[model samples]
Target: MSDHLTVVDHPLVQHKLTLMRRCETSTSEFRQLLREISLLLAYEVTRDLPLTSRQIETPMCAMDAPVLEGKKLALVSILRAGNGLLDGILELIPSARVGFVGLYRDEETLEPVQYYNKLPSQIGDRACIVVDPMLATGNSSAAAIDLVKQAGGRDIRFLCLLAAPEGVARMREAHPDVPIVTASLDDRLNEKGYIVPGLGDAGDRMFGTK
Candidate 1:
């Protein structure tokens, strides 16, 4: 709901997203397109990264140039499909510190529980971006954000390929300060909690599963 939550509607992003939505898209093509879209989204996500002036000698002459300033960003992948997004973001910002958080849904309780957690040292001082391909129920994503917060990550943002309205509302209610970026917002979750008309299970599609 906040202005910070930007839905990137760039032409390139839209084109790739359309291809990704096709049921016929091969796993290889889907993965490739996700990576490409991630890179394009990264450009928009990092547009506000602080820049500092530095003197550098170019082929022409020494001139003041703008370079990334202060602490490098920490890109955290929320496991599985999140890793796909991480690959492309890393391609854009190769020097960014990387982290991972893995969570699984407890069948009976339907709550997310962490299985793996690894974050950069001194996360409080770094801007953190969490990547997950889909924001469906928002349970896992919210839990991942909680894990990042416990690790001292204060400045955080989330990125996803698709999100359900319920998921976005849940996220906003739970963590209003953390803005989310996604390509599209679907209607709502079905009885099974899958985003209606969603591209299906991102993990399944990305990994070539049922």
Candidate 2:
């Protein structure tokens, strides 16, 4: 819950990420690896969820068992690329509430421009996890977080496959309360706002788009 960032360095995650970074990796392979890796990332992100004891009858005798406390989690995807992460996470936490925040960067201004947003009515009551495959400039991610805040989202976390130093710094400065969970924190971003040594455009890679 503290203001910080978590980099998942599990072997499986690292291995899958390496494959994803390869330019020769096919679209289908990339998507498959992303799905597989996301499951591992989801495990780390929800590791600290609050739990409560519930009395349940086992096959033998009745006993108190630990169960997730409070409302179901809210999974918010930050548009296009986020959807790729969303699908995989959903497979792991199928009961979680789903939401979306749509933002696209302006080619000239290089700023986020919001286009669409829809969230659960009780977002504030749940622990929200915002998913995006890549955190580049952090402009779009920061803007998405702002919208979540305005919509009554309180306990929020950001999750991504890859992150750049610039993006991480931006998030730390803009929303220190929200923790970041990513697979890899790569080097600095390039002049064009892309993460160095990143897996190209995440959306394009996943969907075979230009």
Candidate 3:
């Protein structure tokens, strides 16, 4: 898609996201809402997956049926909070290959620090969708995408629960080829580089960690 950013404004997604934004949402509630919303976002992200027909026979009928054309798409989670989004998307595309890129933002610099990386063997052969719950500074996301490319991943797309305009701009400048999909693009990043009016630190909210 030519659009660099896609905001999944579907009613279901928006409603669930609103629930997630509430400060009092319990850990269980936040997790459940994220799972539900990720499925909807996944549906949008995978909408154009190439299709081909496979022959199938029924008791009284035989015909070609549409099936995904190639290797199942790759779903790469950008660590920690990304796992929250990953779990739900996997429920929707059960056959997808999974990968992970672990990164932590350096508190002082607000830049990404890589801690771990693993990917499917045939990353290049499958469409890749990278998942993260927040796109704040975009440093980590861009760095994660760099690792994906280094591992031979192409046709990559980014999916996030929330994004800031600064983060979107950062991605556009760093990896214009990769399009981003998010539930909402908030106003701007605060001085600390967090998305203003974001649902707080996604990892903390998702896992009930400090």
Candidate 4:
């Protein structure tokens, strides 16, 4: 709570989250709203990106203007659901390098196993942002971070649409160096490892699956 977690509580972000939480939100609407909300959350998660000044000539006169410093960020998506957030964030930071960690949770054991892995070269030189919509159990997210670290990602952050208390604790224990940014930190995870009062399976809603 002190150093690791960040909840984007902006008015527009909250309002869009409420619309997304409803049972009746259509797939198209949910996707669109998520895109809109991700734009706002992007502002919060990347708030601390380093900046350096470069001399540039403006319409008025030459000035030392601020610009992003160092290599572009590496935006890593944790498989299918993560792509939802990834799309919108990419819209905002078009030059960011992209990567993916394909993982799915084992239902009975509630553990994450990797199925695919790809990362940008010189990832250690880039700040990494991992995007996944629901931080339910945190197993998959933590495992995804493990892959990122193995691939030489040093500076990393996590972003989600909703997070449960259990999931946050799990992530804190596993990767204290990585910060988490989300739309809402929810009540708890239900018996089946779903976030209580969550917007149901985000993948189902986003892809219109059962």
lDDT of 4 at 72: 94
Better of 2 and 4 by lDDT: 4
CA lDDT for candidate 4: 0.94
Candidate 1 vs candidate 2: which has greater lDDT?
2
The global C-alpha lDDT for each of the candidates, from Candidate 1 onward, is 0.90, 0.93, 0.93, 0.94
Stretches off by above 4 angstroms in model 1 are 107-109
Which residue ranges in model 3 land beyond 4 Å of their true spot?
none
lDDT of candidate 3? 0.93
Off by over 4 Å in 4: none
Q: Report lDDT (Cα) of residue 155, candidate 3.
A: 90
Q: Residues 8-53, candidate 1: write the lDDT tens digits.
A: 9999999999999999999999999999999998987777778899
Q: Which candidate number would show the highest lDDT if scored against the true structure? A: 4
How far off is model 3, as Cα RMSD?
1.2
Residue 184 error, candidate 1, Å: 0.5
Model 1 worst lDDT run, 10 consecutive residues = 104-113
- Which of the two candidates, 1 or 4, achieves a greater TM-score against the reference? 4
| Residue-level lDDT tens digits of model 3 in 156-191 | 999999999999999999999999999998999999
Query: Against the true structure, what is each candidate's TM-score?
Result: 0.95, 0.98, 0.97, 0.98
Worst 10 residues of 2 by lDDT: 1-10
lDDT of 3 at 30: 97
